[model samples]
Target: MAKKVVATLKKEGGSAMFTKVVKMTKSGGNGSYAFEERIVSKDSAKDFFSK
Candidate 1:
């Protein structure tokens, strides 16, 4: 099974511009894990903010 997490990106005013969903997987028994993040299609900030 995989674990999913949601993260929000906010501007200086504290308004959310985008949300990201991360997929996490446990690697070994040593408390190691891997993660993969993707932008939510309907809420991606890439088009609204400049890097």
Candidate 2:
């Protein structure tokens, strides 16, 4: 089974950056999921970054 990350981004209150989370799938095992400085968005990149 392969494991993947599920994350989201939200406006950092008054910051000019975004908040995110890195989650692993139930079947993603553990070492299967690896990411760094990655961005996850529910909308388009432009829309996500625009906010």
Candidate 3:
């Protein structure tokens, strides 16, 4: 189940190693902005947002 994946990560301290990065991007051909979510390693969290 979905809980299993999350449970293991917590047990091994993997949750802290990962981060959620949300980015707002302009829609193609539209003047609207939307949010994008990504699960990235903590080390690259800044890079994801910088781009």
**Top lDDT hit:** 3
In candidate 2, the residue pairs with backbone N, CA or C atoms under 3 Å apart (3 or more residues apart, or in different chains) clash, namely 2-28, 3-28
Model 2 TM-score is 0.21
Give each model a TM-score.
0.33, 0.21, 0.80
- Model 1 Cα lDDT, one tens digit per residue, 1-51: 122222223335333444666666778878889886765544554543332
Best candidate according to TM-score = 3
Off by over 4 Å in 3: none
In candidate 2, which residue ranges exceed 4 Å CA deviation? Answer: 1-17, 28-51
RMSD each, Å: 11.3, 13.2, 1.4
lDDT of every model, 2 decimals: 0.52, 0.39, 0.92
Across 1-51, the per-residue lDDT of candidate 2 in tens digits comes to 122222222234322243454433343566465443335443344554444
- Single out the weakest 10-residue window by summed lDDT for candidate 1: 1-10
Candidates 1 and 3 compared by TM-score, better number: 3
Tens-digit per-residue lDDT, 1-51, candidate 3: 989988988976799899899999998887899999999999999999889
Clashes of 3: 0
